[model samples]
Target: MFENLKILRRAVKAVATKDPELRVQRFYLIQEPQVEFLDRSTHYMNVGFWDGDATTLDTAGEALARKLGEAAELRAGDTVLDAGFGYGDQDFLWLREREVGRITGLNITPHHVEAARARAEAEGVTDRLDFQLGSALSTSFEPESFDRVVALESAFHFHPRSAFFREAYRVLRPGGVLAVADIIPIDGATPRMAFKAGPLSFLKFSLPDENWHDGSTYAKELTEAGFADVTVESIREKVYEPWRQYMAGRVDDDEYRRKLGKALHKGVVRHWSGQDVMRQELDLLDYVIAVARKPE
Candidate 1:
């Protein structure tokens, strides 16, 4: 009961606060460094891209990263800026799989930076992976510094996300691509969804009101930020529904229960275990991969 009250207090404070960055950082601080469901040493923080026998959380997470990397057209000699990179798992994947020349990851959360840096050192890839404490919305990069900029599952927390778009536009070299795997509200969702998602999704997840919009508006924001050849595609079928099913299945699994341990007592865990409830909550969202390029 005390823990639940503490969680409720934090949720109320997050809702009342205007500092989105701080809210987002605090939101992530509460999450386990190793996501409870993943059951792997590698930590990934996203709704996985479920497709083609990618049944595990880690594999689907890698698939989503690969999808974003493909959208960015990652080349062998590219300098990439990963904005709001969580734990740098995708950076490691891209470095080895995509063979990107270098990756500079910027994140606001200190623990994430520390954890990612420790992982980089452990993997002996410190030279290629750079994780720094910074803000994506207001980076300090010079003009035309990177060949690609990507944000995986983290853009929605960026307050006034358009500022980050402008920042991405400014930092990328001419003709360079920008890609993001983002979550936005489904247009015309029912009021019950609106009410539930408002505090749970928006407040607890640090989603700002400005970031709540459909895919068309998302593309328009990139276009307005001086990106051309923009594409915002909804891949919800591959993202949300499958993820909910997987997680709902996990609720009854022994391994998952062992991992979560005492967290099972949390009200949120009970809420998540109900498949219909999870479906309704997830149905309110649209998962999209948005890609655009700076004009040459």
Candidate 2:
């Protein structure tokens, strides 16, 4: 098919490029050609939370958002700092479901920021939402400006994730909560296991420079960043297994093949899909929900 050929060519081109930013951009672009197949309302990119209650992708994604929100103890009047706010999906959920007062989102991706801003305007929540082109490590916001800080399934992409913790601590008000739904390499996981998982896992998701760490490392970093009562809970079974099952079920679907071709073209779908690698090597990774608070 023409789509498959296009995807093949894109994959070759992506492989030839060495720029990390460009590679990331290419990976996101994979969604452009497959938007119709995705749940556009949520625009979710993380592993869904399947707690036996969620029978559909939208509800699973909402479950994950709710879990993060509860972990952060989000209050109706709270001002939130959403780091890596992917397409503003979770932000919209918080605004609608939690009635959060305002959210200032930081994202490195320009197009995502633009889309989020447009979505907010369309939903008449523009006054309550601000999406900016920025990284979690560096931001222009004043110290202690936000009541809560959250990074949903995105902290893993932050190179040296500790830096983001420090920045989050700096930006959060005293007594503010910091919550992250993140992917961590299991303790003692080695490069060999990552390599064996294939190109998407090793090159795209677990880049050497990213310095992905385990739960303990993350907890230590949070404490060092001046957070108190830090907790890191591994919920891989609730996240990975069901998400894998859902995705695997869709793998052979007609719509999924079309999307897979786009992912392939972007060089984002390597030898192994996420579900395949996770099922085969469960010990190499863990999904975690981490929460901490700044002292009042």
Go through the candidates in order and give each one's C-alpha lDDT. Answer: 0.81, 0.77
Badly placed stretches (over 4 Å) of model 2 are 8-22, 33-36, 39-41, 192-210, 254-278
Top candidate when judged by lDDT against the true structure = 1
Q: What's the lDDT for candidate 2?
A: 0.77
User: How many clashing residue pairs appear in each of the predictions shown?
Assistant: 0, 1
Error of 2 at 32 (Å): 2.7
Pairs that collide in candidate 2 are 7-265
Error of 2 at 86 (Å): 0.7
- lDDT at 229, model 1: 99
* Candidate 1 local lDDT, 44-145, one digit each (tens): 878789989678788889899999999999999799999999888899989998899899999999988998999999989888899999999888789999
